[model samples]
Target chain A: MSYLELSNVKKSFGTTIAVDDFNLSIAQGEFVSFLGPSGCGKTTTLRMVAGFELPTSGQISLQDKNLTYLPPNKRNVGMVFQSYALFPNMTVADNIGYGLKVTGKPKKETNARIKEMLGLIHMEEQHNKFPSQLSGGQQQRVALARALAIRPQVLLLDEPLSALDAKIRLELRLEIRRIQQQLGITTIYVTHDQEEALSLSDRIVVMSKGKMEQVGTPAQIYTSPETEFVANFVGQINLLPVKVVSPTQGKVKVGEQILQAGKFGHLNGNPIRLAVRPEELNHGFIEGANNLSGKVEAISYLGSIVRIRLDVEGNPISMDVFNERKLTIPSVGDDYQVTFPVEACWII
Target chain B: MKTKRINFWAFFWVVLAFLYFFLPMYGTLDFSLRMKKGVLSLLAYQKVLADPQFLASFRYSAIMGVITVIFSILLFVPTVYWIHLKMRQLRPLVEIITILPFIIPVIVYVFGLIRTFSGPPFQLTLTPFKTDILMVAGYIVLAMPYMFRAIDVGMQTIDVRTLTEAAQSLGANWAQILFNVIFPNLRTAILSGALISFALVIGELILGDFLARPALGPYMVEVGRDMAYQPAALAIMSYALTWICLGLITLFSRSNNNQRQILGR
Candidate 1:
């Protein structure tokens, strides 16, 4: 059974619709991520679930209780903001114990919880320090501790790691995941970073322009993107136009090449976007592989992966080939041949 | 060559400004000290400090300053917060209203206040307490610009909406959000605003003069006509009081030092 559900949720500000007809059901203790670019409705959906934004028309329920128009105070939801909204006036301990104190928790319980949270975040020595005295990552951890002190039913994190340095962001991301897993709390993380979403989420909801484009597991989202937008937004993808020549045998025509591809299961004899990842294509053809020949236009050496942009009959195709000890790097303006299996081509 | 020219200009202004501000103060101190014709004496300071009128007027203005500060806080803090959090479209209108005191001259505004409340159905000036209330209202209007700007800037520095939401989500009601969360965070801002209002109310001459109130401003002017050294003494005392206010603000901000402090090292 779903622990939290948003049904037909819609939010509009003046004439601008921020979230339109959003529908989803999250199981208990599930780690779900709303992944989208700026101006998408992912943050809005998270805000709605947290009772920060009242949906124009929808039903949001936790278990059996309806929380459609509940104010944030009665929602029992905890949130960590991007700016780490820790109370500057309070010390780290006071900030973490704030929720407990306000909710009339006993002093002994609040003190014990604050101690536990400090130990969890590994900042016990810095309990008396102010937020301005700590680093940005430390401040955000205190913010998370404060949110979790209330023992909320749902945890909402809105781009919580976006404000940190790259190294600290990675470390804190792992820490947050560890904490969430240990607590077994239902969490909704919102971010535009695809790698962050893909690595951290049990299920990912890709959104665009106030609408959900696709919702699936990370592996499914990466390998079998249902729409063109999800395929492009999630990772680097090469989209080439192709025409279905035979519907029965899953045959497609790609620029003077007849390739046996996956079944479209839809319309035939119409041009569609054929999606393929850069790493899917190799530098040489093995047995029973479809091949493409092109002139390399640009070469970017990215330490582990050598990205070569190839111009194949006026269409640019980006291919990432791993750099092994024995393999020679490709140069620009060189004619190269790369191939992928027929099943790797995804028609969207 | 460019460095020399910039240094010359900067040095010129520093010296020019020093003379412009320091000369009159130096002259006043010299005249006030020469009470025994040739020798420097503390007779003027002694006379001013012992006078009954000085003590009454000073105490009255001090009380008036406190009243104005309270009135401004009660009036502007919620108004500014409401306009910021919910009534966002009214922000521009509210800003213009806050700056209205700065746009209209103080003497002109006092005249309007007198004309509006002097006669007819509401003759506030006839009763002493009513006229004192009117004086407090005038002081609030004059202090609106500084107080509102201070508070609005404070709200902007922190994410007011996000903080409010965070507090509300933590089971805090509106009163808790205001008192426990926002009011504590806005201590420096409130202190700064209160100090500025206090300074303005105690030093103001036009309102007290026109309203026929025995505040410090008119008492100073009244003393200037009969006494020479005593007026200079009062000037020095007022200058010291302003410094004391500035000193308090610096002390408070240093304690609340998330931002860089400006005074009282």
Candidate 2:
């Protein structure tokens, strides 16, 4: 059995379903992130695993033990909230040692654990200071250390970096990744930010509404999204409605252009949708590749890369080009041909 | 010239407010001092302090204040915390119910309490002790608005739900979440509320007068009608007591604010 497994978990409040038939198994010492927009049941699923919320239906087990009926305190799962929910009355050391003290660990051992946590979070100087005396980043570190102090069976983080500045968010994101790797604790992270999920988790579960859209590794999820929602939600994808003319040859018709794709998993003459990422498009034509001409509708000058929105036979396409010293940016109203490799086009 | 004018106006309001509140206190202090003879004396204070009736009434009122504070904390802390957690939909209703004391007149409420609790169904007003219990109940109801607001605001300042979850995740049961987590964090807010509740109970006269209790409020009124100097002394003492409560509130909040500033929002 996996370290933590959730089977067909469903949650409903009145008529609104918060989570529906969500199933996932996390291996021991694995870091999995439940990634989606707000109200996508990602947080709800994490809470269920933490035993804060009971699954309205389905089973949850941690290390072959049934945890579905267990309360949060009994489940031995540590959670860090989006808001650093450190006890304001307790000093930094006390906040970190709270779990040990509450679990009736000896005072001496609790003190030693608190010292270790302080060293782990690199906040030994802040042990005597209260949570209210620490900065946002510092408080979150203390909060992180507090969660990790208990040495829980699973560490659940609910958007722990969402309540920070962009720079601090990035810095803490790397710090959390480092800590998770060092601890090798089975961690379930919930986040709305795709970049944070992509840059962190060993595997990402993309959710929408109340259903799991896709669950895969970061590379698999980004490269080959199973659902259109997952493809669009994970990253930028240029979706084109195409008519599949030949499923055997992987040929599809995009308006007036006939393009050969490598993923035409459909019947002949069926209207299917194809997704191509902006980064996959190469400027100028290449031999034996799908070359389509379009008029540049707009050009966005991002640092180090330029994004060009092109109108391809009335179909809008977004293309990204890295700024090469030898290459010039395509302007609006300029005619350009972009090459998309057959393998790069994903049929959704 | 502008700085001079600003300081002048500042000093003007300072003097005006000092006299506005201080004049009555000064007159009462002077009258209390003139009890023995031409010389200023502590004779009235000594008399009031020594009297058994004064001692009993003051002790009764102090006990009532403590009971009211305890009752307020026990009743509202969990009530407000629960409303914030599971029954958030009923928060507005709870808030409106708390403010009903402010809407109803105190005299009418006291009479209503007497009518409800004095009959055969309860007959709580028959015994002096029963009436004392009624007094504490009445005080809790009267102080509900302030108490609930204090606790609700405290709950708002922290992520109460998340904090509760964190505590639970750390192996804390419900009782630990209450005493160790929620209650400790809300210490200052609860203290502020208890102080307000204490001041209200000690200073309240309407309930004491009608409920036929031997509390400090009725004792002061009895002293006021019979004596010339002792009433002023009692008045000054009560004023000082209220001032002490207010001073404690300011001190607690200032310290809380100082720590919060270092933590930052």
Candidate 3:
């Protein structure tokens, strides 16, 4: 049995469904992220798991125990809010010790746990200071420590790093993942930033408009998205509208170029979209399985990589190539031929 | 050039407003501080401070101020929180009701209170406890507009729903969430509203006089009618009391503003 299981979970607010038929089985010690844009129900799913929100119709079980009717306080779940939600009046130590104090633990044990929690977040020196005295990053750390202080069975983080600056957000994301792994706690992180989800989650659950779009390892979700939304949302992809000429051998015609996408089970002489990642397209003409001649409409140099926008067969396509010392970069208005591996393109 | 002209006119109007507002206060202070012969003397202050009636009124007013603050907090803070949390849909209606007391003239309410509680069916005016209860009811109504707005502003500063959920997830019950999480977060708002309510209770005149209670307002009216110099002294004392309350509010709000800046909100 999975450690934490959500079966057909659905949530609705009046006429609007916030989460619909969401199902996932999270294994023990697995760090999973619900990744999507705003209004995608990622936060709602996290809240349902944390018992802050009740599922409209479905079952949520932790270790084979049904927990649908239980209130949040009895759920033994911890959550870090997007706003940090640190108790403003309490000192760091008091905030960390809050859970222990609430559960009627002994004073000595609560004190020891608080000290240990402060050390865990590297905020020991800030124990005496109020949350309002801490910086944004420090406040977030304190919020994390406070949530984890009680050793909850499940840790739910609702975009905890979204409030910080870019540099601080990156630093804290790694720190949070490290802490979750160190404790081997089952964690559910919710975020809209694709890079953060990719780098941090063991698996990513991409959601859209109150429905689960796809669930897979970060690599799988990025490389082979099942839906057009996922492919477009997970990363920048050049979606070329195509008409399938043949079904069995996987042949499609885009503008003037006839392309073979290997054997795709779904496309059968119907108009479908093919998604190609920018990194998969090459800059120069090479005799390959899949090749297209196009004009370089625009070229942007972004320090480490050069982004080239091409007008291929009257359709716009983008390609990202590494900035190397020996290679000649493509200039705008230059006619160039680009080639990519057949397996890299997927029909959606 | 147009912008500069607009700015100049704005500054001119602001100065005019300041003079219009403060000139009466300046006249009142000058009149209260001067002696009967028109020379500035401490005599009015000394006479006001020494009178037994004036001392009783001050003491009663101070007690009522503290009582009103405690009562207003007890009644309004949780009501506002509940409205924000569960009855969010009813917010506009509740807000209208809270401010209704302020809109209705105090004289009308005072008359209603006296008639409703005087004898026969209610008979509340015959007993001191009943009369005190009536006074508290009046004070609550009088203070609701300011108190509700203060608490509402506080609620708007933070995501109360998210904070409550966070607290709940951490094993805190409703009581813990209210006293520890929600109330502490609302400290600045509560203090500000409490200060305003205290000042209002100390300075209020209509309800207490109509109810025939020994509250500060009636006591002040009695002294003002009988003693001329003592009333001026009492006015000065009241001004000092109001200044102190307002000063404390300013100090608290400044610190709260600093904290908001630190949070970068």
DockQ of every candidate: 0.42, 0.55, 0.48
What's the CA RMSD for each of the models?
2.9, 2.8, 2.8
Candidate 3 chain A weakest ten by summed lDDT:
A262-271
How do all the candidates rank in terms of DockQ, highest first? 2, 3, 1
Relative to the true structure, how large is the alpha-carbon lDDT of every model? 0.88, 0.89, 0.86
Interface RMSD of each: 6.3, 2.7, 2.6
Clashing residue pairs in candidate 3 are none
Off by over 4 Å in 3: A283-288, B1-43, B119-121, B255-265
Q: Tens digit of lDDT per residue, candidate 3, span B206-263?
A: 8878777667778778888886666666666777888898899888877765334134
Best by DockQ: 2
**Considering lDDT, where higher is better, how would the candidates rank from best to worst?**
2, 1, 3
All candidates: TM-score: 0.95, 0.93, 0.92
Model 2 residue B37 distance off true place after TM-score fit, in angstroms: 6.1
Supply fnat for every model shown. 0.48, 0.66, 0.53
- In terms of docking quality, how is candidate 3 classified? acceptable
- Chain A only: TM-score of every candidate? 0.97, 0.97, 0.97
lDDT of 1 by residue, B147-241 (tens): 99988887776667877888887888888888887878788889999998999888999999999999999999999999889999888888888
Q: How many pairs of residues collide in each model?
A: 0, 1, 0
Pairwise DockQ winner, candidates 1 and 3: 3
Model 2 Cα lDDT, one tens digit per residue, B92-176:
9999999999999999999999999999889999899899889999999999999999999988887788889999999999998
